[model samples]
Target chain A: MHTVTVQVVRPIGDDIQKKAAERSAVLLLGCPQVPVQTSIALYLLSMLRKKGIKGIIAGNPAARRLVEVSDPDHHYVGEVIDIDRCVADLAEKKRDFSLCFAFIHNDAGVSYAATIGSLSGGSLVALIYGEHPEDVAETLTVPCEKIVVKATHNPMPLKNKIDEVLPWVVSNL
Target chain B: MGCLESLKYEILLKNASSKESGDFIRNHYDEVHEVEAGYKILDKHLIGIPPIAVGVEGDYVIFPYTKPCYGTFLVRVAVPEEVERLRKRSK
Candidate 1:
């Protein structure tokens, strides 16, 4: 049974988590639709589902990215260290053919997330960008071999933009 | 040539690669309203010297490269002839 983990690099906020889950779930459906070894796990620092997750690391950059898009709940899931532990936590929750993705748009601290994903043994990378990001897919190859670089060159706000495009992206993914 | 060789050659290669990358983002910032963009190209070739590397030979153009894959250079994607036919149809 082939198992995969989808890790989207973003701040752990209610909106981002929800969007990430939907995006991950959408991509999950594309995985041969096989029941065997099929599981979906999310690597996020959300307060709502904190107890449900294991292998929680402190100071992990992915957590920082999640922090940037924090919601009004004042319940930010901050500080995760020991990257190896985070990977393990994610691995434990892994299911077969899991599709991890991120919703990073207009993020100033995007480079760090890219770096973490590269070093974290990620198989696939879904780069979310607005303007052309100067070959981000190539930059992220050090940690990941196969990459699915998704760029949104549309000038609409991401929330509205996702509505128009997520359906297509989800279907193809 | 001998003196040049003996001297420490720390030439500041004028960070063209990153400059080009920044320019791409700035110019198309509004048009591509997302935070970033992706470039998909095929057949990018490169050759480098032992110590300090240079020259990124890609499918279309060759330019100086400082960093390995992240270096900023023009990414030329060759358009298939069928697409060109479609463009001519509009004219």
Candidate 2:
């Protein structure tokens, strides 16, 4: 009779701790005047969550409410934080995010993205969308990855871009 | 910082365009933050940089008021409602 002995190796100490330290990402969204932007944001939130990245939505009161109401189950989104405080904290280095995705559709969005990209020492992607996303992208002078798609009423283009870029973003993290 | 003054009018300096005013505010203020379009400062939406310096001294909310031809002026307005809203939002 031949007996086989098996040794099971369990990850301990640093290895387990490293795996437990899940990376966090912040979705910096602006006040969307159109419904499509909100739709795209929700889609992106789902994708981020599926990728195992903890996503925090930072925006104004209305924008925050939009996400809260849309994702009432909290299935895809995490804590909804104030964008102003988020930016201040990032600048002060009090809060550090592994990745940042700024949904830029207007000038204010561009400014927010530029500010966050400069402060956040992580991968930053300026997802520019709307009527003339190119125009909005031009104002984003900060050196960061950008995905500009003319998607005001249609969410397909923006959604596709997100799908394409998400893998690269996760790899960077 | 003294007793609250009962002034109710806004001071607008329209000596510069919106872009120029925004640039000026960004250059001048070290801690400027972006406010949404409909945010009430002095019973009106600020036209300068979306990001503006908001300071509180006593019961007054000090911010930059900008108009096309009037440029930008660091005006303090006594609007407790708006001030309270800002305070709440910041938290």
Candidate 3:
């Protein structure tokens, strides 16, 4: 696992000790044209919440709507945030999350994952799914824990990888 | 006003491929940022799924605009606000 050293500047007399407190994890989902990505996101959200982590989902309107519709009861996730704004905030250091899981199925997904991985002061899991996941993974140059699986119709391969990584992530957190 | 809403000036170059547009921007502009397709530019979602070049030229911003069935076009729009925002983010 590659570590990222993020330098956060705080106001004087601020609660510096709170830096070690529980920070949130963001799941950056790509705008999926298929149904499988939504299913995988739902699974990831449930697992993250179960682990007692403040999990937030960020994506475009389409992706957000898909997740929202799937979890109509809002059991897995609450409000779905806008991915572009989230990226901008992360870049400006206006927002901070401890861990990030960017779902990559296209080149744009890779770029988003790399940008978030480089900006966030946390661990990034570049979960590359869909057909030819390796092609998408190759574009991700940032150093982060990557789980590449060629599973577009079925989410088992990626789910297994997530299961293996979640324990380690929670323990470290 | 928002960047897209305040498009006072625009220069569109037709028959331009993604690589050609990227090269044109790189050769002309001093600062260039590679943004992926589907990413938003001033709240406007960029089309396509490949990475495109967004370059800063003085107070203007240059990026690719793709239309389905039609080829990619290089669009140079004067949006100083977006230029400032991009500068801050790039820093």
Q: Which candidate gets the maximum DockQ versus the true structure? A: 3
lDDT of each: 0.30, 0.68, 0.73
Task: Estimate, for each residue in A1-173, the C-alpha lDDT of model 2 and write its tens digit.
Answer: 99999998765776744543577889887766756767877887787777767788887777788888998898877788987667767755788788898887776676567667767788889888888888778767777899999888888988898889889878777
Tell me the lDDT of candidate 2: 0.68
Whichever of 2 and 3 has more TM-score, that candidate is: 3
Stretches of model 1 off by over 4 angstroms after superposition: A1-69, A72-84, A90-97, A103-125, A130-132, A140-161, A168-173, B1-91
Residue lDDT tens for model 3, B1-91 = 4666476657567755455677788888889977654455665545432455788888888877543223456777777887888778778
Best by lDDT: 3
Please write out the lDDT profile of model 3 over residues A1-173, one tens digit for every residue.
99999999887646533543355789988757645788888898788776667788898788888899888899988657888778777756688888998887765576567667766788988888877888768767778888888888877888898899889976776
Q: What ranking emerges by TM-score with the best candidate at the front?
A: 3, 2, 1
Instruction: Give the TM-score of chain B in candidate 1.
Output: 0.23
Looking at model 3, residue A168 earns an lDDT score of: 91
Better of 1 and 2 by TM-score: 2
Look at candidate 3 and tell me the lDDT of residue A172.
78
- The clash number for model 1 is 24
Error of 1 at B12 (Å): 20
* Best by the TM-score measure: 3
